[model samples]
Target: MTLKKLASRAITEIGAVLDSALPHQVEVMAAPILNAKRIALYGVGREGLMMKSLAMRLFHLGLDAHVVGDMTTPPLGTGDMLIVSAGPGEFSTVSGLIDVAKTAGAATMCVTATPDGTVPQSVTHVVHLEAQTMANDQEGATSVLPMGSLFEAVQFLFFEMVILHLRDQMGLSANAMRANHTNLE
Candidate 1:
């Protein structure tokens, strides 16, 4: 019963958090998606998977979207955009990537739980969400849920909302995205 209550509270609280911030996040993501010259994405670990999913939807919307570290991650020399998800916003490798992208003059956006972290200063856009979920297997200072599971789940949920917004704005058909889904699957 103790375990059940903890799980229930975590889910409800995480849901409440997303319900509050999602509208603003989608609104922030839209302008860059609509106007970007190039849209490259980066995220670490499970967050990377979430960002990859968002990038795929952007591709379905006909934007020039690609994941970072892929063969197709072309130079974002100017006016191009990089969207990264960093929950704590202080992951070492992600910080380094932010540094490189900033030096190259790429516009960057970070969706993070910590607004005060290093990436915000280096990037062009910021979307801050207050999540009580930890990342990885450790209990982060900010996570109420163990090991960031709630954080990972919320990230996935947020991307789906972003896809919904993109579909409406870009006029993408379900058939079109379906066509792009890997045939190997």
Candidate 2:
């Protein structure tokens, strides 16, 4: 396929996954975030990177957002939230962190392709993103993108939409979010 055709196919694949998402997914994910006094997020591999991107946007939206392993991530407790991605449904570390967050009286939200996965089943809430992940990417995968890329790509777009929703709900202007951007960068 030509480069442009390949790009178009990939975009279409990602869009199909996004379109499959439940209409309520965004609102379900955003509610705990808006209610949280602090929000910490985690994921593994490329999913982790996507989680970090969402964290940055959440911070820009004026929420107290942090990455789980960040040096300055404050401890989560009541009125706090832990958002995690487990595209295949479960990750050992993600599960452990969810346990910790729940024990601390915080809510946990999981974004995953398999909502029935162990980690997602354990979380306080789940946002299902139907896409190919490493778990089932080895054979007869639907996406032209390699293992787990579809999930990560769809995830990034989904998170951006969530950010936009939060921005509008909070009555935040783009300039307000920009003001929160790091000047040191």
Candidate 3:
């Protein structure tokens, strides 16, 4: 296939995934960010990278957001939130962290393609990102994106839309968010 065709295919696939995503799920994901005193985010591999992107955006929006396991990350406790992604929804490490957060009195939110999985079962809220992940990306999957790329890509876009809604909900202007960007960068 030509580069143009590949680009078109990717765009079309991503659009289809976004179209089917439930608005209520996104709203559930956003609630902790808006209400928590601090937000801690985690995911593994490409999914983790997407969560990092979201942490950055949430910080720029003036929320106290941290990537889990970061050197500067403080302890999570009451009034804090932990947002995690487990697209296939059974990562042992994520499940462990969720347990820790819950034990420490923090609320948990999970983003997953498999809502019925063990990790989501323990979280306080869930945002179902119904897309193909590496586990289910055999011959019959609809996305042209490889492995869990579709889930990760949708996560990046979904987080941006959540930030947009959050900005409006919090009465923050674009200028205010920009001002929060690191001057050192």
Candidate 3: give the clashing pairs: none
Question: Over 4 Å off in model 1, which ranges?
Answer: 2-7, 133-144
Q: List the candidates' TM-scores in order.
A: 0.85, 0.97, 0.96
For model 2, residues 84-164, the per-residue Cα lDDT tens digits are: 999999899999999999999999999999999999999998998989999999878877888899999999999999999
Candidate 2: global Cα-lDDT?
0.93
Q: What is the lDDT of candidate 1?
A: 0.78
Residue-level lDDT of model 1, residues 92-167, one tens digit each, is 8888887888788888899887777777656788877677535444533544566666777787777788888888
Worst 10 residues of 1 by lDDT: 133-142
* TM-score of candidate 1 to 2 decimals: 0.85
Tens-digit lDDT track of model 3 for 1-185: 89899889988887777787747767887777788999999999999999999999999999999999999999999999999999998999999999999999999999999999999988999899888999899888877889999899999998898999899999999999999999996
TM-score of 3: 0.96
Q: On lDDT, who's better, 1 or 3?
A: 3
Q: Per-candidate RMSD vs. true structure? A: 2.7, 0.9, 1.0
